[model samples]
Target: MNEDITRQLREAAEAHRPDRAQMLARVERGMAGPAVRHRARPFARSGTRVALAGLAAAGVLATGGLAVAAIVAAPSPSPSATVTTPATPSPAVSSPRPTSPRPTPVAPAPATTLGSSRPTPPTTSPSPSAGESQNGPLWSAGSLDSRSTIYWTQSNLALKTTQPLTSLTIEIRIVQTGAVKNTGTWQTLPSDDFTVTVQEADGALVYRWVLKPGRTVPAAGFEFAAQFNNGTAVRSAAGDGYRVDAQGSGGSASVRGGFVPTR
Candidate 1:
């Protein structure tokens, strides 16, 4: 049995033995086939490259769409910046305003006349009847009736001076039968019992004394005489010393009196 098995293996080896030339030819064909396949591989790889390029193009388009969408969705600037731009011009338009015109100047009316409206009547001179005698130790001029009773007198005397004096001293003598029986002294004429109007007439002060009900006057058979005491003389408007005119019984009798300066 061992001999039979050895013989079969020897036969199979001899039958399967390759020819050297044929073996070489077969290896050469196999090498040429790989060279042809290697030459055609570039065409297959070109299709794969086209598919990768399409995928890359799709990725790029998606990225660009995302960028555009982000730009459209973003918010604008704040409202404060828009408000501040218009506020800058508001103060500029309100700065200049129109000025109003000043009122026209007016002149005052001319000065009107002073004091009472009624015109002052001219002073009348007194006329004395005959048989009337007026005498005094200090008498300068004038005559009084010795027999005429019921006499009334009025006098408006004015005194002009360079200096201002507060008051005057006047001496009144009561004469009866050509003798001074009683004497009275007064600081101001007309006293407080009479209505005396004192005013400036023609730039000189004039005192108006009316012998009304309450004034002093002599009774029947007596005469009233008056003169300035010492240091009472003043200048007159006629550029002379002080002078006075007295009218009695409603201009029925009158007397002119003069003042003699003491110093």
Candidate 2:
């Protein structure tokens, strides 16, 4: 019995055994198919991941070292630039200068002349048709003549107004002459022997006589002087009273008489 069973098993194994070449061809085909390729993708992906993690770690270390070197080597900012320092102002100075003085203007004095201070007095001219003197007397008849007469006991002398007259005045002066060493000297009598009349007429005035008594003429002769004003006429009998002898005894005693108009 055992021998029959063994022969039957061998025939079955031989009949069921697989082909190596055919099995290998099928494995290659499966690998080439979607299912088998999908199962193997995890191994390829795991290898790529490890390589990328290594590269990233190297980049991190290099970047960190460069940053540290820049931090250490860079120059510090200057205090002037960072802190903003303020500017300083400059000081101011002043200077003084000298000045010159201006000149003052002078004014000129006024002109003057000599001998111009005093003024001249005025004079009047007399009328020519009146038959009067061209140069009038300096004083009036009343100023030059007297109204009183003197008297003496030895002779009676008189001055008389013998007619009516207007604006009349008379002046009389007595003179005496004597022989001394044969040289005749004539002198006016003293004021006691003279008479003066000063009269002004409203219309006319008349007088009969006025007398003066005097001593007789001695060895010395005598002379008389008479003057009258305007519009006066005396009596012919009184003419002797106005006259003095022009020729005296032996020419020793002489007289000169005349009429002079008042101014």
Candidate 3:
């Protein structure tokens, strides 16, 4: 009977335990009351794997960019590298020679009425001739008046009979009709072809001619003059009238003429 009573007391204590919901509420209260704190767990190993993979990708990109930049920065070589070249500075590009300025053309001189270097025969005066003067030959056709005149005469003396007369008188008589422009004189050559003197009338020398070598005697009115070589000149009438000693070969055929001033 005592053992049955102990068993019944233990049954009564078990039947009186708190309901399950109420027990759960008490456990929640204890948890929320700040009696404990929860901790986060360490990251998964797979996440560490992902992070390592991303680092590897960034390293690859950086390495590729560096390699490309190095290649681009490299220098290139010139084509003539192998040749030993002269150091001569590139020939200064000589500025193309400035073209010589074209020369200005000159105008030709005009035609003139003035006489040529060659001598010309004196024009005869219109006045009547005075008979041969006491000085020499008789005046037959030309006048010794102020107007310039040229008088010529043939010698009757034979070349043998006549001593060579190279000298002759050249008179210039300024008559009432004579003009002052007639101021010069000349003695004729023995050849009867030319007349020359230092002055036409005390003028600068002018060689006057009636004939030239290798040329024909001019027409009756034609006349011209040229200078002979210095020694070639025969003595002239420059003194005491123009005079010359004639060469002996030709005699009577030797002719004489005088150039006289009229002014």
Candidate 4:
């Protein structure tokens, strides 16, 4: 047929023949297995390693005895790392000082009574008695009598009472300035025990006194007076005034005033 197909491809190319010396010994053992695993990791030929931390200073690389090159000086932080020192001072204590007591020396009183009158000086008492009354415990005082004559003028009041008065009155007034009438009125209390009067009213000269009915009033200091005339050389009893009202046995009192002006 084409010479038996060219003799069956030359007998299958002489029955397979490709050994080239065993494929060049298996490609030289696969390139000597990565060059013996890269020379067994001999620092892998160090020339680029820098993983630093603190205090280290290596050097070595003039270049190439196997081409290594380390200039590591990278780590530095500890110039005295954190130095500290200085501390000292403590001492000061002083407390405790308090003592008081000493006063005893009196030997002269032993002559006790050679004249013992010095001790009699301890007798105090009797204090309260000021005037101007309003409700009870009475005491009074009014004035204007220097024998007052810049034309007449009398006025006086006095009163005192501390317990026996079954009701009383007194009045007095005056104020009218020029030739003011009413020239008399008086009382140390019993003129028949009160009920006196003088009159003229409102622009003034009043007088009054009153107490008669079984009449009582006796405790002490009495006086009452009035007398008038007033032709002024200096007579401004500034609206005169006097009022009294008593009722006692220690109770209702009322004193009032206004006539002062006697030099």
Candidate 5:
């Protein structure tokens, strides 16, 4: 019952605007005789609600000269006017003195970003977990590093092939989430065994690793990782992807896929 009354009161208060015309009408209605109020006991709750709302509204409306209206509506005797004269104000005291207003509050700074200490809830939709996707002969998997700070992040890519490759090129594209820039890259394979180039094109940091002449990707697993700056907030890698084009004794085979999204 208390909750019901509170809900009704809020609804009534919101419906009642603190305005002049309604104030006078309410005042006249509220001035009913005691006998009339006694006969209206059935509507007691509603009456009390309006009366309380009207009192609160009066307090707010009084700031807009409702007090003067009250004086005019119910005039007092001439002696009451004389009584107010003695409460006179001096020019210096009442000439719109410079009152010091409360200083406007400043909002606190935004969240200072850093790597998540624990597993943090992602901001984007849940995606396939890392080590989920397999593309062609090149069994590929990807995951964002746990040490990724807000301003910079790293995505690790793992590649595996069942067949030894005579020629291979690995292309990893880091989707342009925000302020993305490649800091550096590394791989499990010998650095001299591959020609690596990192460049920005088509709104992404494109990292390409070509098996150097005569140097081949083995049948075993290999790791090719790249690190880049993501920006000041957790990022999503929905569009980020990779492609592997390789030629073995069997024939040329290719596979392409995107990195799972992350926050």
Candidate 6:
């Protein structure tokens, strides 16, 4: 999978659809207060400057060796509709920018590294005094791109540990390598509704968007297109993002910074 890391994972999957449509267009143009504290840090710094321009175009597509044709492909999720979620234990924010702006456009350098496994960097809860009543929906980005295969799943739960809540699910899948078309399975459901950390407007960062028990819309967005080889963990540019949800489920979500590059 090297065609410049599949074109920098297709420009980090189209730069997360315009950095999530400019954070839903700045929450419908209200300025969204500092864009919600740098929402996903400019789409994780434009997904590491387009993944370092896909490692400098993977050295000119690996010296013009290129291999990995079969463009356009992302659809595979029907294995009896699965989608599970109920692990818990993970929270610490930071790392997820490039939802838009600029600084996220490059493609003339190489020095990559990012082999998954860096999340886990968010902690600092405090707020729940006035009459007490807060839970869920602080950060929950769903995914399930389609075409032939491509699935994703994300949850930060916002360093949870309050106690007294319920409902949570986050699942994703996408399998399809060969066999023209006659052997498939694993297309689960239950996509959103973590509860949105109960409105989340204060300091922000308390999310929820679960749905895996039976699903009614499971597949959400971002199907395939991701790469990060070489050493990995590029100086913790952006880390923290892995929380299942459960255990009294008080709810929370806050990952302030973002950025991850190495290869």
- Top model by lDDT, which number? 5
- Give candidate 1's whole-model lDDT: 0.33
What does candidate 3's lDDT look like per residue over 1-263, in tens digits? 97676455545444443344654564466447454644424565566456657655545554554454444444555576577787989767767877898999997432111221222333343223222111122121222223211321111110111232232222222211121222233322345544434333443233332333433321122112222221222322222111122222232122233432332
After superposing candidate 4, which stretches have Cα over 4 Å from the reference? 1-74, 78-141, 144-157, 174-200, 205-235, 238-263
Which 10 consecutive positions of candidate 5 have the poorest summed lDDT? Answer: 116-125
Clashes of 3: 26
- Candidate 5 at 187: error in angstroms? 0.4
Alpha-carbon shift of residue 154 in model 6 (angstroms):
11
lDDT of 1 by residue, 1-263 (tens): 97686555545444443344664564466456544455448877787577557645544554544554444445655577444444444444565667878878787532111211222211221233211224221122223212111221111122222222222222222212221111111223335644444443453333334455534443222122322111122212122122323333333222234322211
Clashes of each: 0, 6, 26, 0, 0, 66
For residue 221, give model 1's deviation from the true position in Å.
26
**Poorest lDDT segment (10 consecutive residues) of candidate 4:** 53-62
Candidate 2 residue-wise lDDT, 129-232, digit = tens: 21121111111111111221121000111222222122222232222211101111111334343333323233222111211344223223222222222212
Query: What is the C-alpha RMSD, rounded to one decimal, of candidate 5?
Result: 37.3
Report the candidate with higher TM-score, 3 versus 5.
Answer: 5
Please give the lDDT score at residue 78 for candidate 3.
54
Off by over 4 Å in 1: 1-43, 78-210, 214-263
- Please give, for residues 1-263, the per-residue lDDT of candidate 6 as tens digits: 67688777555544432234554464456433563465568889798678657655654554343222224244444579566887896896779875875686677432211223222211222233211222343323321111111221122122222332344432212111221111111112222432222222332222334544433321121111111121222212122222343322344332222211111
Off by over 4 Å in 6: 1-204, 212-239, 246-259
lDDT of 4 by residue, 1-263 (tens): 97675555445444444444655565566446553444435464342232111101111111211122111222445587565665665666667676666667765532112212121111111122322344566777676655455666666777777688888888878877657766566665567877787888677778888888877877776677677666646677867878887787767878786666544
TM-score of each: 0.27, 0.18, 0.24, 0.24, 0.48, 0.16
- Pick the TM-score winner: 5
